[model samples]
Target: MIITGEDIGKKFGKTWIFRNQNFEIQSGEITSITGKNGSGKSTLLQIIAGYLTPSQGTIYANGDQIDEQKHHSVFIGPYTEVIEEFTLKEFLNFHQQFKKPVCSIEEMANSASLPLDKMIGDFSTGMKQRTKLITAFFFENDAIFMDEPTSNLDDEGFQWWKDLLKKIDQRLVIIASNDQEEIKCCSKQLNL
Candidate 1:
């Protein structure tokens, strides 16, 4: 899969978060979107993920215009919403109804060191982040977009994140982060 953004820009009211941004991201590579705070890194990522529309220009996935509903892409971020009301097992089961995971629920839980019976609401911040990462990584998707992926991770969790990236290295992975360690695996950089 190849995703291309042509002269992409976003504006809120009178101020432009970013303008005239362009990029070509393809499968089997990791790309980093880097910039300081309030520099629109996350905004650009959202636009690519089809969660937000750019004020100008267009984004094409494999030559066709992007459509969130039809696209098989997963977005993982510190703030990415998960069902806190459901237990880990329940949540995974629910997710399977829509998209199948690359592994079993037990395997995912074990890999993340999360308890299947525990409610997501009760998990610590690091654990929650693990949950998000495992869910996104193990899912069958063409693209994975992450924002501040290591926000709440500890040393071990951080290593787990890196290892998981290797396992899914063939997929199109784009991350929006300022942390050098987080973006180290990226081969290409899009400086916003």
Candidate 2:
């Protein structure tokens, strides 16, 4: 699979996030988008995920142009990662209701070390992020776009995330973060 962004640019009022930003991300590999806050890290990701219309340019995921109205991309941005107050089981049920899979949630949870009995509202931020990532691993999508993936992860959890990315197949993992460790682990870098 191939994800190509050519001369991608975005603007909010007079604030131009970035212009002529380009990248060609390949399948079965991880790529990091690095930049400071307000430098368009999240904006660039949102544009790729088809959440926002770019002020310029276009993108193609797996050789097809992304449709902004459709939920083709698995967008795991910070604001939409998870819902509050749902128990882990309930959350899993909600997530699976949209996509049927070969393995059960229990199997996925066990493999990812996610808790099933705890309330998400009571879980730590890192745990919450892990739960989201675990859901992403099971989601039905060709690509996964993660914004600040290591934001809430602890050292161990971060390592788990790193190792897990190395094993996924057929899916493109595009991460937006400033984390050095994550950047090092990725095969390519999309510097914003």
For model 2, residues 13-121, the per-residue Cα lDDT tens digits are 9888899987888877788889887789888888887788889999877667877334434777557747768888888888778865536878877766778888888
CA lDDT of each prediction against the hidden true structure = 0.90, 0.79
Cα displacement (Å) at residue 49, model 2: 1.0
Give RMSD to native, each candidate: 1.2, 2.0
- Per residue, candidate 1 scores C-alpha lDDT tens digits across 1-192 of 899999999999989989999889999989999998999999999999999999999999988888733667789897888899999999999988888788899999999889999999999999999988877888898899999999999999999999998887668999999999988989999998
Query: What is the TM-score of each predicted model, taking all chains together?
Result: 0.97, 0.89
- Clash count, one per candidate: 0, 0
Residues forming the 10-long window of minimal summed lDDT in candidate 2: 68-77
Cα shift from native, residue 85, model 1 (Å): 1.3
Using alpha carbons, what is the TM-score of model 2? 0.89
Candidate 2 lDDT (Cα, 0 to 1): 0.79
